[model samples]
Target: MGIRATAVACLALVTMGCASAERTPVTSTAERFLSAAGEGRGGQACLLLAPEAARSLDDCEKQIVSVGLRAGAVRGVDVWGDEARVRVDGDTLFLHRFPDGWRVRAAGCEPRAEQPYECEVKT
Candidate 1:
């Protein structure tokens, strides 16, 4: 291959790798959060939530579990900057990267026509 063509191919691969790296953590955080909540580990789930999201609930631990989150097979993930959306079998979750790591900002989301997603739990 020509040098220019090789460089372009290498750049494309690097870009794709970065995207995959970002998506992995986002997917992992969403799955972990859902699993924790679904399995009645409310405290663990709450710890995975964004600060403002956790504070939105009066009782973070109890209320997080009551949200009825489920851990399903992850179907898709989109990461933009420090924000990400993960779509699983029965749910979509939004998360933001923090200094510590990624944390769930919203969950149990359903799309609406010409509107933002309505989530059962959000920041």
Candidate 2:
């Protein structure tokens, strides 16, 4: 009886740890997106897209490569429910949740007074 109770408690602890842990599923998703961007794999980046954007962005894989964005050095990831914001340098990339995973809604950078520095369409 004591061993069974201990086993149950351990399982519960593992479950809780998996949920609130810093590197939760959202974080992993964010990391993968950034890593693909770092490698200049736009098609892979598309894989992270919220459905509509993914469909729209799929055609232009070269754009992803040409942007010269590097994702491997991400500073941090902020997760708020189904939405997560990934910080690369000072820029913030936005994403939406999907049954498949996370998809990019927008990729934002600082110095808000922009000059079309961002291409809203991944294409």
In Å, residue 91's CA in model 1 sits off its true spot by: 0.7
Local distance difference test scores for all models: 0.94, 0.63
Across 28-114, the per-residue lDDT of candidate 1 in tens digits comes to 899899999999999999999999999999999999899889999999999999899999998999999999999999999998999
lDDT of 1 at 112: 92
- Please, what's the RMSD in Å of model 2? 6.3
Off by over 4 Å in 1: none
For model 1, the run of ten residues with the poorest summed lDDT: 22-31
Model 2 alpha-carbon drift over 4 Å, by segment: 1-19, 56-58, 111-123
lDDT of 1 at 24: 85
Model 1 whole-model lDDT (C-alpha atoms): 0.94
In each prediction, how many residue pairs overlap at the backbone (N, C-alpha, C within less than 3 A)? 0, 3
